[model samples]
Target: MKQLFVLATALLLAVSCSQNKAPKTLVLYYSQTNTTKAVAEEIANALGADLEAILPVVPYDGDMGATAARCAKDAAEGKLPELKPFTVDVAAYDVIFLGYPIWMGTYAPPVAAALEAVNLDGKKVVPFCTFGSGGLDTSVKDLQAKLPNTEILPGYGVRTARIDAAKAEVDYFLKSNGFLAGEVTPLPDFSEVRPATEADAAIFDAAVGTYPMIHAAATEVASRAVPGGIEYLFTAKDLPRDPAVEIPDHFIKVYVLAEDGKEPVFTQVLR
Candidate 1:
């Protein structure tokens, strides 16, 4: 009976330990050149999360010319490309990492399709992108507009040329966003600030009109100085805008200025 009691206690301890383990994650990525796909796999393996591939219902051309043509047409028409069927039980995980390659200065259409098809109301979303030159291109901003009430963390982008070399950055990003099971690191506050000009306001207004969930706005109209440049104060609002100011090509860039008029505090390009 004593031996039986010892076994029961040991089993109980094991169960408790297992129950306290870090939550699992889900990695969803859409890649054309396989760079983003490779990164997604690495992150999933590192975090012990399930891997999901987001494919479009309409296939994309692997060649640059055809793909570019298709993407351009879609953008011009404001179309949300359809995605292959994907299902996720909202309660299965604590975090979802959405990965994609930057296409035409924004999130890939297939990724948008995937997000639209599924619901991510209460999940923490971490977006990672691979870009050739334009860097992150407004993926986080665009996502915030589309998905409201979701905790969409700031994204990380690696140059396509340096993708294989981005392991450290990828690890840091995952750790920073609370996706990987580890001690959480502090992040700089990234609240959206209002723009200074009517042009800026129009650009943000267009984005809000499109997504309408991020609560982005034009908060302050004044500018501040930082180390190298000026920081502009603005409110981030999520709402529709007048069609007159909705031109996509000429939206204002987002930036943070130093209070002392020394340099730019920080910056993110918004559309």
Candidate 2:
């Protein structure tokens, strides 16, 4: 009886401990406009994670032109602007979701500043980006190089102005990347390939200079071939190359619209 009682007590203690353990997640974002903030909130809500805002010591002007100027200046200087004081016990979370707007075609320097402030060694860093229309613009690659110690995954990017329409896209992106689970409705037939302007053509050419695959002929570029008539390519090369903007080698991605509606039937990295 005494032995049995001890065994039962041990089992009960193990069950209680298991039930009390919580999943660790953290959502951190830097937003000048609330678009990134809203998207970040949705992710945090979905993950039930702790939320932290990366604020600069000096706030940025929301005006597009002024903001562009400021971002350009910073990027040119490679300056790490001072950030408002904040803290995260990095060891506590197993995963961290980072969100930011694509400023000057790359991540806002303030995002880099926030990253510098924290140590992400051994942590999982998942990045989500918001842009006016330029999309991720090499922010993911840049972050990977910057935070070499962290185990980072491929990230999701959304147009800041169209985030409301991107809700399903956001949900699908997070899930496909393993941040969330369950049946994911793929992205819709959302891509529309339009005529490329001279500048657009030039950007594609420039991106190839940075990413050699961009200029490769369809046969030469070896990835899952996106079938014609089923794919859409959105090209934007009017991406300004100003010092204020931290634009990296921004390129385009091609995706096939899935029949299930809003789900990408296929996806490819163009550059």
Question: What are the models' TM-scores?
Answer: 0.58, 0.65
On the 0 to 100 scale, the lDDT of residue 188 in model 2 is: 50
Candidate of highest TM-score:
2
| Candidate maximizing lDDT | 1
Give the lowest summed-lDDT range of ten residues in model 2.
Answer: 217-226
What is the Cα-based lDDT of residue 5 in candidate 2?
A: 100
Model 1: per-residue Cα lDDT over 144-180, one tens digit each:
8998978987877776755755786678767776566
lDDT for every model? 0.68, 0.67
Q: Which tens-of-lDDT digit does each residue in 78-173 have in candidate 2?
A: 887798787777568878888898876678888888887888888888888787544464788888898888888778777543576567767777
Off by over 4 Å in 1: 1-21, 76-78, 87-91, 135-137, 176-178, 181-271
How many times do residue backbones clash in model 1? 24
Residue 251 lDDT (model 2): 47
